[model samples]
Target: MEPIPNPSSAHPITEERPGEAPIFDWDWTETLAQSWETLLLILSTFWCILLARVVTQKLQLHDSPNLCYAVEFGLVILPCILLITVAVDYSNYIGFVMFSGTLWFLRKNRVLERARTRGQFDLGGNRHMALSVLRALTHLITAINILAIDFGSYYRPYRKSLQFGAKLMDTGIGLFVFTMAMVSRRTHNWSDLRRIAVYSVLPLILLGLARSATVLVLGYGQDIHEYGQHLNAFFTLVFTKFFGALLNILARKDLHLLPLGFGILLIHQFGLSFLGVSDYVMNDDVDRTNFFNANREGLVSLPGFVGLYGLSIYVNRWMVASSLLSYSELVRKLRRLLLVVLLLWSLFVISAYGIGISRMTCNLGYVIWMLAIGSTSLWASFGAIDFVINSVMPWESSPSDEQEKGLVTRGTVAKGGDKSIVSFTISQALNQNGLTFFVVANVLNGAVNKFLRPEDRSNCESVIILLVYMFLGTRMAYELLKRGIRLA
Candidate 1:
């Protein structure tokens, strides 16, 4: 085996010394460690969904979404960051809070009885509560972890280990791609390609170029291993979107996406396994002199992510179809979703044992790992929405009207002064323009890193800094939603 290269040496322009960059220098944990961490994240996520319902629906708490934004900041985003940061050491305490909080709301409100009698509240196929919550949390967690990973309170295990195994931050880029695919509308006609390019691809390319330029100019500490010498998160997103758009136009039907996606994955994995592609990407001794070698991680990983994008489009098609089914049929479809999650997890385990998980290469194990996590999160969020939250706060809309329009405004106030069932929520706000929100968070992360040395801070200081940063970051999304803006 070739000797491993210093992760920092590839980015000699950064101010960081050899092997001392706070974010880049870390040995990752075994895959088994991710299970416990994932459980806590899921638990906190479920609790956030429940609490959002109880506060906005049951209690009629929306005097103004503006005033209530702080309530969300404290209840939903705060505990979540705390669970992963300052409060991480107290797993039992945090776990009890998440468990008891979710249980208390469920039992105290009598979810089952309400669900049985509340009648059906259809918000159409696309604006699903379960999927909405999942998408929101994806943005929330990704935003938090980017900045949190620099702090002393942030555990090393949660950072992107790069070399092997799965970590929370490691899953961020793939989840973003998957979530974007879930809502991607099928494009028809080459004429639409220009609009897609201008609206979608252009922004991502600009963001990628901007980030790459800023990092080099500011001499920010970078982990070249994460995306190679020049490529960053934005470029990965750009390529994913660009390629996915071409696929959508060429396929011309949702039905074609599933099988085609699977075929792509199989072929990609074959090359990695048999063609020695994985060996080349993982070899640290390789020099980063050419564009391909310099950005090999970003380029090689594109196929896996594009395949994931195709697969997610199929999953979204399934969900849209499932939403139109009768209650019993919907339940069965949901059960099937659970089974899909199980199958993905099994595949992930098999792949991990066979080739090991590597985010750098976006190898078979990494792709399956992403699918398993994304599917499980979607399942849990959907289960909560369908079984509990939907019944807890029913939408008062006629069945015929819902069927005809197949849409409901997210921030609509219920008629007859009934408590606003679908009032403004942090998740709803963030979902308005998720990509823009992510960009704002990245800017703030860079700013914070420039002024503060989080690696040297105490737990209390770190938590306070993170909370302040989160507030400022979320505020942009929330305020933009208030102004009826959607920057994609």
Candidate 2:
């Protein structure tokens, strides 16, 4: 789906909100109603998996440490596309059959066997967790995005889902930037930002300008700012990268610089509110729609997300420690990490209860919630999964250890590799070439929205069209990864 501008920091807070409208008629009720049977079936399928995991662990049914990574992607990600694209009417019987088969398609995702390496808690643990959640998030959005609507209405029960769903795409974008910046910090000097900015951000500006011009010149006025594909480009190229560069300067590669970035983000969040910035965006229809909307969204709403990038630096520091420790010592660090997550969650709860959720204005509450939820969930998930796997198979062998014994790193790996078969294809593809696929989605969306009649399409037709679009994107991603190319 095309990115909307500064679409108020995202999910739980934006239910049927008034400011933004969708590109198409998205009846939340209708969409959910039509899909509920299938939805319930999917949830049940997931439930069964969870139950099976518990059973396996309890009974020690499968001592295979690698079973931690087993999952049926064909069922989890594929059949949903198939069901939606062809508009197959949901039948409990058919769903049962399909989902049952999916249960049998388990494959290794190569998740971490240990939470720590040497003496420190491994940051790679979070990488695996984020990759899993992010891929699932990507796939869900890609599926629903076929209709090309934001589903931003707060009026629906799915308001929370809608908001988080939309927010996930950009959050993923910001998360990666922060993570890579942590990586880059170890390699590059501060002075390299200008060169990096030019190489990265400039292309986005040019592409955005080109897309905007196409909409303006060709009379494609619908969601013009968004359709032009500039919003994400601005966030990724400008705010995410450039702003990060400046912050990196201030951070001076010192871990102490993290608190500074965090402090600055807090100031930005609260200072703007005190200055009536939040009031203006929330109440001023004209300015909100203009400044906060697509055209110059980067101008108004990016600070919080940029600040998020800033905070990620501190988080990376927390996740990555100098001490290489034994497994028991790493568990101590995990306990402390869990404590930090609780504190963050407390902040989120206080902020939400105190100020209420508002995306229209990038309020302090919004900032706290996103940062707290995002960071906490990542760490907690990592810890939880690592704990479960380790407890289940204390002697599990990883790829490195297995290789010493001449075993394959990944079992019976396919041509497209683990990414294609392990998790959802769309996310695997998007992860491989997020920027390129994003550009492709925008260009293709603009064309389809301009030329095609979404309103007249049957449900099955919409599903098929979206599936086709996602497939092409996936193919492009596979090819790009195979060739070792990426715009990002």
Model 2: how far residue 373 lies from native, Å: 3.3
Which residue pairs of candidate 1 clash? none
| lDDT over C-alpha atoms for residue 458 of model 2 | 60
Tell me the lDDT of model 1 at 445: 84
TM-score of 2: 0.62
Clashes of 1: 0
Evaluated with lDDT, which candidate comes out highest?
A: 1
lDDT of each: 0.71, 0.45
Q: Give the lowest summed-lDDT range of ten residues in model 1.
A: 20-29
- What would the C-alpha RMSD of candidate 1 be, to one decimal place? 6.4
**Candidate 2: worst 10 consecutive residues by lDDT?**
412-421
Q: Evaluate residue 40 in candidate 1 and report its C-alpha lDDT on the 0 to 100 scale.
A: 66
